[model samples]
Target: MPKGFQAMTPHAAPPISVEGLRRSFRGPDGRPFDAVAGLTFRIETPGTIVSLIGPDGAGKTTLLRLLAGILTPDAGEVRLFGRRPDTNDPEFVATLGFMPQRFGLYEELTVWENFKIFGALRGVEGAALETRFRDLMTLSGLKGFEEREAGKLSGGMKQKLGLSCALLSEPKLLLLDEPTVGVDPLSRRELWRILEAMRTRTGMTVLVSTAYLEEAARTDRTMLLSKGRLLAEDAPDALAQTTAGRGWRARALKDAEEARLARALMHDVRAASDSPAAAPWLDAVPHGEYVDLLTAADHTRSGTPPRLATDAPEAHLEPRAPTLEDAYCALTFPETRAVHAALAAPARRTDPPAPTRTAGNPLNAQDVQDAVVAEGISRRFGAFTAVADTSFRVRRGEIFGLLGPNGAGKTTTFRMLCGLLAPSGGRISVAGVDLRTARSAARAKVGYVAQKFSLYAQLSGRENLEYFGGCFGVSGRALRERIDELTAGGELARRLDARVGELPLGAKRELALACALIHRPEILFLDEATSGADVCARRAFWRRIVDLARAGTTVVVTTHFMEEAEYCDRFLIQDAGRVLALGTPLEVRRRAGAASVEEAFARIVTDARRRNAEGFAS
Candidate 1:
């Protein structure tokens, strides 16, 4: 038995219990603010998985840290197994395992070395440590890679290794903080599989925080947090029942028709002021030529409810079962849905129709040309190839996705397209300008939003926009007008005077995007811009993207969220610096023989890895 386990005491209380938990910090202006304010909750059952769901600044991480005994709460009582959770208590500490958002792994050490260090730290030694380490490696799919350096592993593999380290002591409870934030679909599934197996075999309790609602649904129970307050806590299916009969799907004959139907539905919802009890439109998510809309049954001024229109001439709407995502949206953004409806209405009214090529029109000929083209693009560092023979084209006013796991060459390709890195071989063109001959001219027509926040933290949001506007050659009165235009009627307008560093994660991402679009470039590149954003933030971000594409701005984006690919006209999948698949989302799914883009991506990468291993053996 482990040394710490000998000190542990049995209790008849719940695994976790908390009351009036609070934590505060100093703001950028040296003012005090509360991150977690008077939260009360309990985990009553063991051997079950619970999920913490909330937006960017909802105090999920703060609560986790407080429970781990890493940070002292300002005012609260936290009990683990009926005793106070004190880091100084060996018995209390030995019962829990915590993995933070950023795992601190020694990059220079091999996989096996890292495991040994963690195991020894937990007081496991000799034969016990060796047996535990071997079991972990086998369970995490890292048995063959024990000799590989930690730094050389991919993002997914590193996450798995981190989980193994957290589980070395075999604690009764595991606490994970957003473990799948930027991981690929296949690896994400694998991580969950390992967690589930641990629970089944050892009856260990698991609590995880996540931004993906789909992932939250897989847990036994979900606790929704907002502004550090527990709004609701219940089983996943029971929570989803809150918005039943409110989901609807609409299919159109063509892309243009789908856009038109979406606009008309928005107008109808806006115009129906008589129905005061009706829920606002939840979402207008687009999938190729179809758009799925979610809304509640309309209640008239007399309190009479009316069913949804399923046989309308404009669209074919069918009632669908509610999902965890729908329930979450209804709970979090009940009012913000109106804001989206209003924002999308005017864009549809003013946007021009798709241009058709004509024999006598010069403008039509120019419109037919591709906005971005890459032929045989390749990048190499010494003897290792980063991106190899990649080719893809983005037409004007289209959304194109570039997707792959980390260390899969997606970033390398993105950098070459943005002109941040030079390609070793290829012909690259942007907005009808050749990059090799006139790099400046080609760069001038593009806007880039990096994966991480790129702004002066100390500066105000408005100031950062002004600075970037001037850099893009918009100055004097034009710059001021553009800043006002971008911030009008959204969250940015309310937080213009706040410093960028002090703002919430969602607000910071929105400001970054506004800065990138200051000059109104013809093309845009977004690299994981929605990585850590919440459901509401992601919806607003995509609405802005759709509006930009409607106004003739070509978008090239890379994201880990597979659902986002449904909005793209087309996308390319890459692995190990080679293109594995390229087509519409549905087409790619069909070719991979999978139901969704996420599953399709996993299948493609799994096959590629198998083929590579066979080649090496030969």
Candidate 2:
């Protein structure tokens, strides 16, 4: 048996296989939006995770649903272990496990109860059910609180329970739809651990859809779904190799200036808009944002978007490896607004440098102070000490990140930071406003995008903004102006009048961020706001966030991607509700002696866990 991500004995069979699949959804006006058109993929080896990556409304969910036998595609073929998937094969259905983006389980049931009921539904009972329950409980790290009601479980735990339930029958096929969206980084890793473990153990094939490009890159193979069609399908490495022969990075202007550069490069004789940038790239010459192909000597002018500069010492150059992210951008032909703007001529800044520090009273109308402050804060739930004395702060114009493992108290701490729950003890302020004096006022000074698409799905983007603006007391011209400002610019502006519910997952998230920033709050609290979005959308969303941060809006973001951690000015790692490490991302990783920020967080928590054990084990 594999015992890692998939466990399959010789008795095991191929878990899933699909052929020429097609699907569509009813548009807002009742037109058909072909989501998955003529898609084809196979799951031959058990325990291999295959991802369907694309923009939202790309039919990822539809494909998964079709495989789960929950929905029949308009035209296609699917088989689970050599049997047609949509047909009712009690044995196959019983053996297939699915975790939808919105998985449904009885909210009132205790974790154990839900597990048991699911087990029973699949006809596992008596000692077998008990044993399965015990194994799943441990595998999911769901011990010590089997009695915790489902309703009481955090988002991460609930999803874990859903997964455990899915694994209860030991299904030969597993399907997961963006299960780690709002889950903290630590939790996200733990979930992956379980995923890998299951794959290594069962040899059961797992097919999943994901918003994280890194996740897609890690999969054995991937399908790039675009507006109802299969854009590409191949190994991630092969996909990246398409542009691997020529790859380089060049420094461009920052923010609005960068936008200008991107726009200029977009129309410039070649190339178009790409997405997202943080930190600075090495200065290059010919002295434009793009790596002008004509500027490059070896360049064959094929349809391939030309590569930027590398090793041009006169260009103050630095060479780096091409990333899967870069490959995705290239293959997808992502818009290069950044490149375009980078190519534009520089504009001199006549004004002198502004003051480096600005502090205002928490009660003042001008929130010119630091974005967030925390000191010796702790949270406790009854006898359980969730978060211990944690302290960190974020200055204006910085992207501050918070990371931790699952069950590490990241969410608990977040709730406290958001004032959704009061800290058991601590001093905290947000956007120069003390959370205690007037929570609403403090909240008003900050923009927040929750992990879930909590916006009114039924409302059009315009109507939703109006209502949310009303909550902020913006009316008449002010409200309209604010709304216009939010939905302004590139892709999002085009969807202002579209129904929020009808928008793709990526568009909805973008709209949410725009809505949160409608009032131009001094700081933005993005609590895992990019989790279930499709790849292109996620990139576009991040581009917007970078724009916000560069515009001097203090941004505090929580995310599962380590690469994203690179964007932050600094970060704090939390585990079991305690701050374990704090510093610049590079510093923290160096201190932890780990290769990546995620690895550093794992190291810190491992150290903390060891300390806790030794301190208490007598």
Candidate 3:
């Protein structure tokens, strides 16, 4: 920004301020668990979006709950509208809206009915609520389907309705605990749009917790958390600026393909690691680079600086433009590569053990695949088609993803596949077992992690896992062995006896996964499983899933994080219950023809919208 432009920036007193807040929970053995040591922050405006970000075990959710007065802080104070958060003032609580990580909507009630109860709880009724209800349904794209039972709604739809409940009263302060967790990319985008629109119109004070850096980018300011500590806090633009001039994209170089060279220098680093998990390309630093750099003979490389000859001809340097991703990586993991290098057993990539791919006839693609084939699947509530003519296949051992905006057919598809809902139109077969015909057997062979942690929180983590294992037919010695393997020496095990509800969001997520995988199902379905956990937790969860897949588990996942598409062996992009595109990571990226999965997704969605528009015009 120019000097004059900087002068135009707004400066106002914070609408909410927190000082030295801390929280702790008692362990099963009566030990006090210090979750949040100390946290302090201030939000200046009602309209601004403030994000609390951190790795697993960070105090983000604890702090948010404390501010919402849902949980009492062990120490210090949180003030909203200059009053203590625990004021017990109905007017004060009414001025604030809080959405928990696990929302408490009545699954048995219709979407509109659930919203009505929540609105009534907040003291809004009659005509005023009717107006708000209409507005929220439109904002959520559930206008025609409000009469549909919440239990019958898709995961994304449930989340949207949860958001709508929070917004019905037009609270001055909004606390959203990972509101977009199980939503598809398209749905996430719509949610962002609604939040932005709400912000622009009401100047509402919005605070959110997220594991995604992309979501953080949407916030006016963000606080990075790690292990119950605050690492850094700053405006998005300022944080991005710190990584200026240090990032690039590089592909292979060929003699005849010189013309394809872009501004970034191309090189081959044989010694460098190449793991999808670590993103070797994105994380590569030039300190130990070995390459054949561009010379005066290569005019194809764009914006090349003048080169000078030296005694050694092995190295050439190029100035590259840094991106927000690069900046975020650099700031968060400045010596990440160096730290990895210091370790003697450093692998170049985040490669898991090789997958134990089952033996099957390659020519018989349709046979022996651990897949969910949903044919002619359709769900209807009254006159609305939540899912119509939806059909798809999730291949064996492939990390298949469902991508779409919110209120689309993603959740409906998942339910049909899992036999949670009998489709109005068709059939779902899992690993050759038809769900509608053999629901129990089909379900037993499938492991699922819901968008929200479904394990009982009041119970111990270990108990939850063991109980879930039993539900899936694993019991006695086998269950014990599996539990030991999942929990032993792992962080999940270390927190074994801890009450599930008392654990951090990340730990809760890990426990949920442990439960899902307890039965060693051939098919796994994760519905936005990593939505609200910290970055470290998200990383940990992905690592575990990759491990599970390598062990021959067929994983089907739904996520709002576009970057995760790179992890999928193949992915299907959906918008409004229709499959827009489907292919491998590279294929999808190439089809979208963009730098990263995030960019490709944006471009693909835009193209999809354009095509829809033109078709309608015709």
In order, what lDDT does every prediction score?
0.77, 0.66, 0.65
**lDDT score of residue 62 within candidate 2:** 82
RMSD of each: 5.2, 6.7, 8.7
State the lDDT of candidate 1 residue by residue for 263-371, as single tens digits: 3443444422223255345466654445566664343122222343333235666666677777777676643443343233223212223334333322334433887
What are the runs in model 1 whose C-alpha is more than 4 Å off?
Answer: 1-11, 28-31, 253-280, 287-290, 296-313, 334-368, 615-618
Candidate 1, residue 301: how far the Cα is off, in Å: 12
Which candidate tops lDDT? 1
Error of 3 at 25 (Å): 2.3
Q: What is the TM-score of each candidate against the true structure?
A: 0.88, 0.79, 0.68
* Candidate 2 lDDT over residue span 1-618, tens digit each: 243443445665557767888877777667876777887776667667787777656677888888888888788898888777743667867778888876567889998888778887677888998998898889989988799998888777887888888888888788898887766555666678888887777766777777777777878888777666677788887776665434443335342232233323322322223222321221111112233112121342343434332322122123434445555555553333332232221222222122232333333333334567787899888999998888887877777888776577877777777778899898787766677776786777777888875799878888888887887777899898766665544455667677787776556766787678767767778887866654444544554555566566778888766656655667888777878888876578779887666677667888899999998996
- In angstroms, what RMSD does candidate 1 have relative to the true structure? 5.2
- Model 2, residue 510: distance off in Å is 1.9
Best-to-worst lDDT order: 1, 2, 3
Clashes of each: 0, 51, 7
Writing each residue's lDDT as its tens digit, candidate 3 over 467-502 gives 898888889999998887655434455678888877
What's the lDDT for candidate 2?
0.66
For model 3, the stretches where C-alpha displacement exceeds 4 angstroms are 1-13, 45-47, 86-97, 102-172, 240-366, 369-397, 415-484, 497-505, 512-523, 547-553, 575-578, 589-618
